[model samples]
Target: MDRVKLITIPKIEDTRGNLAVIEKESIPFEIKRVYYLYDVPTGAYRGAHAHKEQSEFLIALSGSFEVVLDDGIETRRIMLNKPNIGLFIPTMMWRELDNFSSGSVCLVLASDTFDESDYIREYDKFKLFKST
Candidate 1:
């Protein structure tokens, strides 16, 4: 029941600023889709569900936020405030994104396309699924 983990990507530094790169080799899974969450209202929350099969890597492109992960038995909280770091969220784990600062941008690199059948949106049902 391993929860989410922070992944450090290759960061190239220069006088201009810094750049981080995430390739297929850097992540555990092959990325099939890329999406980002931004313009979140102050103190708002997102990602109140869990994926059944799809895995994802989350990065904070700007500003900061926190992710709450639950694996039916234990819960953990991870803060995302750096663009060079990302969070790898495996399947069958519940995740919630909250405590978003203003102008925060959360980028997500997914392992699969959008599939409604792969999502478990209810906490009770997710717990039941884990019991099996």
Candidate 2:
């Protein structure tokens, strides 16, 4: 919803493999947690929630997928495919992942550890919370 920053991480290409690294302070926030979503069936969606404090960077590692971001009042869609690019989601922005390709892998980097209180899972509740 609010202006989120999307950064494209540079990929180091090699004869054997490619690598992309994220160091502390390299991004807007420090790295506190990491997670990935995989084995998601086609037409299935994920991540219909918003965070209170956590900032996230999402990457499509294997296949292409669409990330729908809503900032309560407005919405935007982002297409992710390359491993070197990542979407930086600011706090309080609602997000949803959809149009996942087969064998798609979505990786997420977080700025905070798991805290139940930071999550706002309901859209209406998130809208109300953001307005205040």
Candidate 3:
């Protein structure tokens, strides 16, 4: 609800396999850091936080997972199962990742390096911050 949307990463198909490509121009923000999630246990959760200034693009490199997005006033759930599609999350929106399938690989492209101060880990605090 907070302007979250999916991006289509151009892919080149062939008999051997398919290759999905993501360049600098594919995202709204310049990617400054990259990381991934893998081997997560079933029913385990990740990314229960919101950023104040940073944005992130998430891709399901393998298997599938669900992303829950909250904007203090509204919430939405999205499924990520395709390697050529991705989710873009803008600033100040609460996000949580769960419902991971076995062997799932989640790739994250970040707009900035890790910063402890930029994170809002509490839901109440995130709501208050959004209200202000």
TM-score to native of every candidate shown: 0.97, 0.93, 0.98
**Candidate 3 local Cα displacement, residue 118, angstroms:** 0.4
**Quality of model 2 by C-alpha lDDT:** 0.90
- Give the winner by lDDT: 3
Q: Over the stretch 1-132, how does candidate 1's per-residue lDDT look in tens digits?
A: 464779898999999999888877899999999999999998789998999999999999999999999999999999999999999999998999999998999999999999999999999999999999
How many clashes show up per model?
0, 1, 0
Report lDDT (CA) for all predictions: 0.93, 0.90, 0.96
* Stretches of model 2 off by over 4 angstroms after superposition: none
Q: Which lDDT tens digits does candidate 2 get at residues 1-132?
A: 546877878768899999887776557888889999999997899999999999999989999899999997888999999988889998989999999999999999999999999999999999899899
Displacement of residue 86 (Cα, Å) in model 3 is 0.3
Predicted candidate 3 versus true structure: per-residue lDDT over 11-71, tens digit per residue: 9999999989888789899999999999999989999999999999999999999999999
Report RMSD (Å) for each prediction in the order shown: 0.9, 1.3, 0.7
If ranked by TM-score, best first, what sequence of candidates would result? Answer: 3, 1, 2
Candidate 3 is scored at a TM of 0.98
